[model samples]
Target: MKQRFLITILVIAMFSGCKKFLNVDPLDSLSGNNFWKTRQDAETYTREVYRLFREGVAIRTGMILVGDLRCAPVAYGAYPPRGDFNLLSSNSIRTLVNTPRIQGDINTYWQVHGAWDVISDWTPIYKVVQAANVLYEKAPDVAEADQSMSAELIRKYQAEAVFMRCLSYFFMIRLFGDVPYYTNAYNDVPLPRTKDVEVAKACIAELEAHRNDLPWTYEDPANRAVRAMRGSAIALEMDLNMWLAGIDEANKKMYYEETDRLGDELTASNAYKLLPMENIAQVFAGRSEEGLFEVPQNVNYGDVLGNIRRTFTGAVLHYPYIQLNQNSTKSELTYTDGYLKKLYPEEANDLRKKYWFDNNIYNEDGTMQCFKFFNLALGENNTTASLSNYFIIFRYAGALLLQAEALANLEEGSQKAEALLNQVRTRAGADLYSAGTDKNLPDAIFYERSKELMGEGHYYYDLVRSRKIYNPDYCYRPISYGNFVQGAWLWPISEKALVNNPHMTLNNYWR
Candidate 1:
């Protein structure tokens, strides 16, 4: 009955005034006096925050465009070597959006319209913040009205609300540098952008207070990693600190220390872990033991969201993963041979190379497709069906690597860093690490992340946070330090943001 009621609220959310208020003005949605009387009401509203976040990312393939493609070494494949991938590879933002849209499959494959809108707009993400704010403000009241809703349960739900809010802000800070920060319920004041460092600090404090309110794991199998847990909060806290350590030089050591300690705590908890490389499919299939937090996508339940063509698999897979009749047998995109060689030398005995790529792994042509985000095809070969996969936001391996990265930034911490880095390498059946003449421990950890997290929408942000976006050795699309200071790395704020707010300004660097 509870599950069905939640579903019913979701259905109503799509059609009723609830949806309108959430989209247009979150403040308006909370005007109701009687809405906060039940545990079910609190729970239903909390789930919408997750749904809104999934929609924001999945609908337009936002993460792939924002996270993976920028500054990365990639080339066009079976499709015509169009300007889109080349532009992204070169960090040519102005030209990429302004160029005439390609006709036919290329246009659809790129989803240029959606990409352009998502890159400029922050509305979708703010919608999530709004919903979360509502829940955070109102969840406490549920305990007063519902005899069955305990204070602990209300606190847990409120913690989930804050988790979603912090997660949304972290994503925005990476993309836009600083964004307008708020937590007051029904806040409608027009505001200017906050400094990214300030936003990070505030979110860190907020999350630290509420992290323990969440459980280590869920009793229900379906809620395992999909719901926020202690592991999820800790993992997010680690990433936010790492981001802070990268940009805020004066306080970087403190940020690094916090990340290292939190990582130790997360691992020591033993609440999450890496699955064997042989069970790689299970890892991507969602709700796995390794998942810290994920945007759920289940094709079996008719709950699949977003365009597959623009997803990581959609951009790379061909033939068997997609229908041959309407799609090319060759992949639409592939990593450059240079990048591939840099990530995986021919001499390295890594099992990931064998498990994740096809025979033409080195091909500059679009023939190479990654099998990391996919499992079994939905139908027989050549069927127009998507493989079962989930949009993983954070997982145990990523957290491990993040911990390794944080340690590497600290003084006299190389040995400890190597230990953390090798944990991932050993799992991949690759030779364990020792700092060598050619590659230092830091670069090894960076490339290990590059190799392990190839298509998961993390590499580009990794480059940005590490200041590697300007280094030609690390980035294929290196911008000069001058441009970086001019906010070249930040996405141009949409004109829509300035419509009602007098304090709003755009990222003039793009202009």
Candidate 2:
């Protein structure tokens, strides 16, 4: 009789365990120990962190929360009952002022109060940063089979992490002036707010250093691994430098110079090109070219979240109405009399007017529904498809406009600026380029930006950089408070972050 040899495989699975598997003392958690060891491990871990980018930190909440749209005219606890949507009303008394809600509400204080509120809940982003930090610091020691390739991969991932960190800080400073800067994710010490000038300088330095390291393409050669590309970094650099230019005098000059240099680079690279005027909507229809970067959304992915404008502007306000079905669920063809009357182009031949807004389109029941935001397939109740379109953070159009703005600010002749502005307007099918006054070069650019980038969130920044008060009726009303400091454009720090971190200080204007 042959002796049968039985090989037993004992697989011990641990969830959220320590960094090391064998040294696990049973009481120690297994989650932290087993992170980012192999290429696959690093990729998987990085994907989870990338999901935050897909979810909305960079685009949806961050940009829309600051720009003009719907307004809340009533106070916080008033009869109308204001929430996030109504926070933009100037007269509203209810103040939940923070970084997230600063532009829209009263008491736009730039302490730690609201600043922290917006970003504190971004636990996933921080986790991604932490993972990336691990890859940055530890990936080299893996004694990888392909040494140079491994180091390059590690640097690419690290560059992404740095991009996200710097991007977050950029917004933080924009919303809430001086914010605590942390290079290491594990640091528990509360950091004092760095000056805006210093913050801009530091972020630009980081971006410039990592620009060459990022890959030009996103599609991974091995197995279709998606990651941030060099184009994304360049787009971010253009935006950061452009924004930084708006602050003070000397830094303004430096940033403008940088913006011109980067903008020229972006144009020359040929990696990104502007989408045609007709196909512009298709860019936002899904994953398309015009988007330098976008948060991915799908019904199956459980990432279908409503955009701020579509939620409030399309649903509650009448500009573009949401059509409803028999099930009481929102439909796509919502119309508003005000929006049509105010924004519609005078020339009937203008294709963009028809492309962007709704007309006399009707529903099955003969009810007139505006197709401005029509997405019947993705109703409110449907978890699979969301009405909220992919929020476009940086687009090729923005790059072109930034280039135009930079040129306008740098050059003496209005002809160059006018020509640059015309490039965008003419593409949009607007006659303003030919007819509009040349004297109002900046205003022309501003109006063109408002119309072209409408509902894409750029108005408030234009207002801030120009130092012009936003027209109340034309735009959203300005909210004010007694303690509110002038030029307190940034949001106050969140009350929570201040309580947690001791070294953090209130912004100068707010203090």
The TM-score that candidate 2 achieves is 0.73
lDDT of 2 by residue, 1-511 (tens): 1111100000122112323211112221112343333565445445544654544364334334345432322212211122433444342222434434346444342222223244333333434444444445544444353344466777766787777666666655666666556565334344566787677678778888986787665553321113565666677777777766766665676676777678778767776666676666556654455566655444354333333322322332222233222233332223232433344445434456666544443222123333233343444454224344555656777777776777677765356667767777677776655424446566666666765665555666666655443444434344333333353455544444455455656545544
* Cα lDDT tens digits for candidate 1, 417-499: 99989999999999889777545888888999988987788999999989999998888878899999999888777777776
RMSD of each: 3.4, 9.0
C-alpha TM-score for every candidate: 0.91, 0.73
Clashes of each: 1, 34
Whole-model Cα lDDT per candidate?
0.78, 0.50
Task: Give stretches of model 2 more than 4 Å off.
Answer: 1-33, 56-63, 70-84, 91-132, 141-149, 219-226, 305-349, 360-388, 432-437, 470-488, 507-511
